[model samples]
Target chain A: MSEILERIWEYRQISRVELVELTGLTSGTITNLTHDLIQLGILRENEAISGNVGRRRVMLGFDPRFYRIIGLDIGRTSFEIIVMDLNGTILQSIEREMNGVQGPEAYFQVITPTLTTVKQEIEAAGEKILGLGVGIPGPIHYESGSLLAPPNFPGWKGYPLKQMLEQQFDLVTLIEDDARTSAMAERWYGLGKSVQNLVSITMGTGIGGGVVTNGKIVRGTNGLCGQVGHMTIVLDGKMCDCGNRGCWETVGSIPGILSRWSQGSTLMELQTAIRQGEPEALRCIDETLAYLEAALVNVQNLYDPELILLGGRLFPLLAEHLDQLKPRLQSRLYAFAKDRLRIEPATFGTSQSAVGAAALMLGFLLSEPVRLLSLQDS
Target chain B: MSEILERIWEYRQISRVELVELTGLTSGTITNLTHDLIQLGILRENEAISGNVGRRRVMLGFDPRFYRIIGLDIGRTSFEIIVMDLNGTILQSIEREMNGVQGPEAYFQVITPTLTTVKQEIEAAGEKILGLGVGIPGPIHYESGSLLAPPNFPGWKGYPLKQMLEQQFDLVTLIEDDARTSAMAERWYGLGKSVQNLVSITMGTGIGGGVVTNGKIVRGTNGLCGQVGHMTIVLDGKMCDCGNRGCWETVGSIPGILSRWSQGSTLMELQTAIRQGEPEALRCIDETLAYLEAALVNVQNLYDPELILLGGRLFPLLAEHLDQLKPRLQSRLYAFAKDRLRIEPATFGTSQSAVGAAALMLGFLLSEPVRLLSLQDS
Candidate 1:
């Protein structure tokens, strides 16, 4: 049954005959499964495909109006919300600053009404809400939907964000770590579409990573798998807030880069200075690239992914210099790895987190369609 | 069918009634499958279980003498070979020094005759030869049984090792990386017996690593997944033969530790001096531990494995210092990781690579029992 659905999803507007060929399912089983899925409002028949023949053929596709997902990205300094269709197309999206939001209660106060407005707008558009997916920074208790203590966000420790949102919106909710969510977004709708093994990294205030292997995202034992920023790049070099010394983020992150240059320059200023070939800024950026090279080689040796997708605040600046960085990065790796490792800019850009959050929901639905059926009962 | 074989393998001895209950198979199905397996010589019926009352029961178990596997480990300076039964018990074994042997032809000349002698001895003992499993150091094209260019061995690039052995021995050959082979050894019978996710590190002349997730070893995109030793620990600390600066092995490995001193002292001398509290040796060991701490922390953040198994030449020395090293290692990690990470010495010691090579064959047999049927035809 999932084979048929996946075939339809892949082809977008595939006919029954094409789905049968693609899925290698008997025509009768395809007919039966498609009928049942259509009845459940999961799939819909499209307008007739008019061929130069006696009878026109009807196509099948995801019923965009049937189910909607709200993807929420809660990060260190900002939050984003996006309403998307079953096919992962964004219906609406909004980003807001989280500068003054302090505690869980304060965050709830800001998000609850905004969520309510988004829900009303989605309902007004006549799409049934399937679920909400929230992507948070730091370690997450994925099974319990509880955000663990992230050093950057002190107050979010053990918070039942999933329970609160599920109760408030009265919809099933899926919560994931931001890095893993971003990786999923890439796997579903961006550069990682056809690749099975890859690492998606976001280099912003801090570096983070997620791994996808054998076509599934690995969340690790405690959902702490993608903490690439905390990986030690320097041995006893500098103190880190996490109580580590010489972490990759200490030298490669935005604040880490700025700290070398009087500490008050914004990312914009640094980018401009580097573009204008300022020596001081160039030196700092070069040092950061050196650290980046080490971190990337470390990841390359560890995961050996087909591609490494780079995103977040530093992506645009680094993307422009990727050609220069690639060779240097490749040189640091073992000979066998140099032949296969590829580093590229993330395709989704600023929209990655939101799309990734949404992808979390879609991934869940697609991975376990039986769970989707169970959710439909509620 | 694999579930039944796995149950028999796990229990070692079990009655038909117990097998039915354990596997949830119908009693008739259990009887039929066991009968078929026994007829195929894969299973054997043991002596009856004595009972005070009622009819006695015959126990089913693996036929230890039914098949045998040759486990071979080819490292940088030495090689180990062992013939083992289905239960992973070594029947015969040999260890030989590489002694400046270089290139594929030289290594093959030494191994081919040694393998023939081992085969004759096993045949004299009346055991059926199942396959040969070769564990070599460096990047292996696992599917093709080819070894790529390893820095330590310059001449053996793109060598079709698997084809040579398969045709020579006239048996199916399973070739794998040495580090990954040792990791397989750990997963099957060592510290990682119960832990599904683990990173196995071998700190010897150089460093190496292997990752096991969800009870299966991860070979990565190019079979170079666990090159943890080459990860840069110092930004520009030392130049390495692999064309990298400050690789972990540059400062953390056995040779690296000895180089810090007079350069000719052996590992045993360093351990003796450190144990006797010699100041210079203690300093060298401390410096080595610092590098180890950084490397382990980096791996912990990346894989988030439940266990970190330390193996190779430094295993005994480091295992002795684990008590002193644990706290320092934990301090380097994020708080969340600190709570869950465990570092343990690999249990198999010197025999790990050989046993792991054997496990590679057993693992393949167990993972896909249907494949065993195809092998029977050949």
Candidate 2:
């Protein structure tokens, strides 16, 4: 049944005959499964507008109006709440900025009212709320869905965010690291669909990474496998917030680059200066690029991923320099890895983490529809 | 049948009752499978050495006399061949040193005769040769089992080593990178038996790493993952043979360390000097440890394996300093990973790679007994 749903999701609108062919299910089994799915409001049938006029076959697709997901992205500086459909279409989104220092209580005070408003709107529209997925900016204890010491946001350490959200909203909830959530977004809805092994590097104010191997996120023993930012690039280099010296984050992060450019130069001003080929700006960008290149080479060597998806605020600024990066990496890579590893900009701008949080819920729903049904029944 | 064999391999010897209890297979099924396995000379039944005075149940165990594997380890400086049983016992072993510049043909000249002598001995003892497992030092095209461009050994580039051995010996042969093969040996017979995720770092003439995740080797796209030696530790510090600057291998490897010390000083002399607390030797050792610590921290951050098995020649030299490495790594690691990761020396001494190579074939047989049966039938 999940396979049938996955086929429909892939094709968007596939006929019953095509489903039978693609899934290798008997026509009777397909009919029975489709009927059950339609009853659950998980799938809908529409009349196909075919070129041939013999008969208009019924095509199956997701019933977007029946259920919606609440995706919350709690970033370092701000938090966002978005209502998303199964098709990843955003129904509503709201962003609220906070000072760098805020405790869990203050965060909940802002989040509870916003969540209630979204829940009410969802109920008023006659759409069932599937779940809430929160994307936080640090390591998470996957089983408990609690935050592990997030840098700068020390107040949220060990907070039972998943349990709190589940109890307050009375919905199924999942908490994942923001980088991993972004990876999920890319895997399901963006360029990652074509590849099984991918690494998503999110470079914003701080650097974070998500590793995907064999089409699933690699959550290591403590769910801290993709902490590429802390990887050392320089011997006895700059001290980082993590208490490490010469972390990739020290040189490759947005703030790190800006700080090196000038004391108060904006990213735009630096970009302008780089475009004009100013020596100091070029020198700063070159240093950052060198560090980025080394880190990228290290990533390629360590993971040997087929595709590396670059996302977050810093990637767009570096996208233009990627051509230069390729040749440099090719020289540094293992012989077999040369020319095979691809570096590309990730799809989805600004709302990547929010959509990814929604994707986390959607992925769970698609893979285990019975769980969703059980939750609804309960 | 594989499950039963694996259980027997685990316990060394087990009664039908124990097998049934352990595997959840019915008594009748266990009896039938054991009977068939005995007929095929894969298992042998023996009178139980029982402490309890009841009906003395018979025990089943592997028939070590029936089959053996030819394990060949081809390294940059030398080559070793070993005859290993299903229990990983070294029945026979041989080693030969080579000039570093020896090509594939020259090395094969030495290996073929030694392999033939071992095969003759096994046949004389009425044992069947199961297969050949070769551990080569370089990136390999996994499917074809051919060498990729190995550093310093340019003549071995693109050598079809596996096919050549298969054609020469007329035995089912498997080729794998040396570090990965060492990991296989660890996973099956060493400390890695307790942990599903492991990384084996072989630091000898050069540095290489093998990653095991979820009890399986992570052979990334092109089968070129776990190249940790090439990961940059210093930004533009030293030029490596791989054309990369500041590679971990350039500093952490045996030659890398020796070169940093007095050029004429042997590793033994340096070890002696460090023991005497000479200032220059202490500085060199400290520098080496610092690089090693940084690389290890990077490894822990990247792979996050529960156990990191340190192998190769250089490890024993630095084993005493591991006490110092722990606090340094703890201070550098992400909060969750601190104190959770275990660093231990690998079990196998000089014969590590050879035993690992044989274990590769043993692993294949244990997982897929049908493939071995078909080979015998053919």
lDDT of 1 at B358: 87
Given candidate 1, what's the lDDT at residue B34? 89
Fraction of the reference Cα-Cα interface contacts (below 8 Å) that each candidate reproduces = 0.79, 0.72
The DockQ score of candidate 2 comes to: 0.62
- What pairs collide in candidate 2? none
Q: Residue A126's C-alpha lDDT in candidate 2?
A: 88
Q: Candidate 2 local accuracy as lDDT?
A: 0.85
lDDT of 1 by residue, B1-378 (tens): 788987887778889999889888999999998898888777899877467775677999988877898899987788899988877788888898987888878888898899998888777977777778778877887777798767676678899988988888887788998889999998876777678899999888878898998888998788878888888888887988776788888888887889987623888888888888888888888888888888888888889899998889777878777788899888777676687888877777877888888888888777776786578559
Top lDDT hit: 2
Q: Which digits, one per residue and each the tens of the lDDT, describe model 2 over residues A114-227? A: 889999988998889888888998788878878888876768899988888888889888889998888888888787777888888899888888888887788777777888
Chain A vs. true chain A, TM-score per model, equals 0.93, 0.93
